[model samples]
Target: MSINLEQIDELRKRANVSYEDAKNALEQNEGNLIKSLIYLEKQNKIKPDEKPCNDNTFFKNVKSLIKKGNETKLIIKKNDNVVLNICVTLAVIIAISAAPIVIVGLILAIITNHKIRIVKKNNEDSQVNKIFDKVSVVVNKVTTKINEELKTE
Candidate 1:
């Protein structure tokens, strides 16, 4: 099939390829404009309908979520009355610093009929709550184990 000069020029302009490359693509694809474009794309001489990856909204949202998680409050209550309220980061620090105390406190809370609730201060979404729920489950398992061991002894 004979490829015209106009077809080569148009392909060069659309695909951002050199004159020789565009002409070669047209020749290889049997003078079909669509197939020539596909050939150029396959050869990495042109990008085919690509969306820009410059959007920073995803990163911004992740940063905001991290900030929100840091600001989230953990409220410890005894008999429906608030005993302690601290941010999640601080709670994590305290838990790390006083692991034994934290475990003993949880056990005591269980015995004294206390409730622990994690609350997100600014965000209405449940992302932070979901994380806290997982943490609470782990804590509950540890406390239950400790309770069992105490009973056995």
Candidate 2:
């Protein structure tokens, strides 16, 4: 079925575009909502895609994004078994009562353990991972450097 008039109207409101523009985009794109949105966005007509910004749909999308973000945060905040164990072992090896080592170890443990969790979560979340993948490389680099420095010292 073609995109309905109500939906087009809603999109117009959400996107903050003129009635004629929204109608033309949807009609020109032939029921392809994403294409219509892309057209509008490319033409500098809207805010370049949002959560649709209406009722349950927008809120649900927001919640899903929040959930995805939270899951990612959890993954970045946990440590894998090997990393955690190594952290604990290092703390012990570093000093008798090395508070700094222990704390750092704990932090690393929390960070690396999150990897698998985030990976698993990405499989379930569509756009969530796309957003994160963009920044993953930089984050990985910083974390790797931190790990290397900690190991050396």
Candidate 3:
């Protein structure tokens, strides 16, 4: 059986294989383009389009964030002793629901020589750690500025 130059060239270009391999494939498949392509694929001479792996990074980050939140603690102290200890999530809820109450408590704590501390129980390096560290730095700066202002007043 004879194979045409065009068929061989087409198969060679489509399969990204050498001319000889393409000719052999076309001849073996009786000059059928689709069958020759399939034959090349089956022989591992051509690679099929690959699908991407499922990325679950977002879900992993969310899970880690939740875990970090659970492990975070807000401790209110007076005279080097813990007066109140609560998880970060609960503190946030209280702070949000009763903003003025929280502010008053903080001001009173400052006036009475009390200390407020945020403690992270988890020590693992993660995306959540980066976010929490940045937030902590900002909060610390703001708290220090407020304390300075209050002291001067």
Candidate 4:
């Protein structure tokens, strides 16, 4: 059956899609009446199968990739400047609490002992950078995929 602008206008009104959108889809299907319907159906931006493409092949791949990221508890984190300050403060608190007896504490306080400082520093941050780095990677990967898809569509 032949489909024309008038018929498309009717369908577009029924579909609640813009005239431009209907026109484009109609043109893209190259005048094939059934193909246009199928295209709209596949997009799920239409009735009959209005449920969006939730578990589509693309999302399934993304979910699998995320699962891989979760296989190890390693996660990158957002760069929050305040977190750095907190890490430094906690390290100092723990160091003071673990201070040896009053005598040794006085000695440690007097000396510029670098070893204890290093240990406290590691404990305070607790690999915050490593986790954030992983998160950033995941975000970039997902963003790249989304951008690529948008470009193609």
Candidate 5:
């Protein structure tokens, strides 16, 4: 088969090889682009492209997120005293493993006027803390109603 300049130029750009090598690979592979790449690879003229986001990269990103979570803290305070302090990651594990217990504890804390705070390592504000603030407002209203009912009874 006859080789054309376009085919040679395309191969050269793809393989990052000289004009002569591209033309030769194209000629040997009968102008097939995929086969020319394989031929150049077999001859060690071009290196294979690395994936931008492979398994290793994914795992690295997960590790980084976990690390950041560990650096953040979940704090429960009662009467201006810290009652419970734990890493955000461990708190999540506990909350997932014992969801009922976590819910009960949160309710009791809310009833007892304990404060829940998510503090980051750098003391920066988090949207999660804002969520907690909103939940606290709702729980406080419910608890106040319950207290009034108990008093009435």
Candidate 6:
């Protein structure tokens, strides 16, 4: 039996099967949509229906990212001495829960000549550390200028 592209596409969308699989199933089932679905199900070609806006997949991706973040450490140092060290996931949680305090603490850390570093698992350097370093340099320059102006007043 001959099957049109529309039938194959409809079956593919409904069963989440590939184009060839859908076309084969439709042809084998005499171009009947319901029978094609059943044929695909029997062949184990049909997968669990995943909607376009799938929340389960979204949550799974978020969980994976958080796991990676927990494996990575955020380190704050001053004078080559470790001042604070915590997992990135926990730091994010704390920052979210206390945004103002986190901002003030970060500003103070920069003002006090502290270094912010991100260390991945296996002690690999993170690219985020470069951004932190640049920001710290800019903030230090501004603070120093402000202090000089205050002293001259």
- Candidate that would win on lDDT: 6
TM-score of 2: 0.28
List the pairs of residues colliding in candidate 6.
Answer: none
* RMSD of each predicted structure: 8.7, 16.9, 10.2, 22.7, 4.6, 7.1
Over 1-153, each residue of candidate 4 has an lDDT whose tens digit, in order, gives 455788688657666666776776788888664677677767875654355686588998976765543332321122322212223334434557775563464343323211112112223333555554455456566667888999999
Please give the ranking of all candidate structures by TM-score, highest first, separated by commas: 5, 6, 3, 1, 2, 4
On a 0 to 100 scale, what is the lDDT of residue 19 in model 4?
Answer: 70
| C-alpha lDDT score of every prediction, in listed order | 0.78, 0.60, 0.78, 0.52, 0.88, 0.92
Question: Model 4 off-target regions past 4 Å?
Answer: 1-3, 47-153
* Candidate 4 vs 5: which has more TM-score: 5
Tens digits of per-residue lDDT for model 1 on 2-112?
888899889977998889999999989899999989988888999454546545788778768668758888777866789988877788778999999998986676555
Candidate with the larger TM-score of 1 and 2: 1
lDDT of 2 by residue, 64-104 (tens): 76565445422333333322222222333454677787567
Question: Per-residue lDDT for 3-74 in model 5, tens only?
Answer: 999999888878889898998998889999999999999999995555566458778998998999899999
TM agreement with the true structure for every prediction: 0.39, 0.28, 0.41, 0.26, 0.63, 0.61
RMSD of 1: 8.7
Task: Output the TM-score of candidate 3.
Answer: 0.41
Report clashes for each candidate as comma-separated counts.
0, 8, 0, 7, 0, 0
Q: Tell me the tens digit of each residue's lDDT in model 3 across 1-153.
A: 689999888887788888899999988999899999999999999854453543468777877876777798777777789999987788878999999999898776655556667778863444544554565566667788899999999
RMSD of 3: 10.2
Better candidate by TM-score, 2 or 3: 3
Q: Cα miss at 95, model 6 (Å)?
A: 0.8
Candidate 6 regions exceeding 4 Å error are 1-55
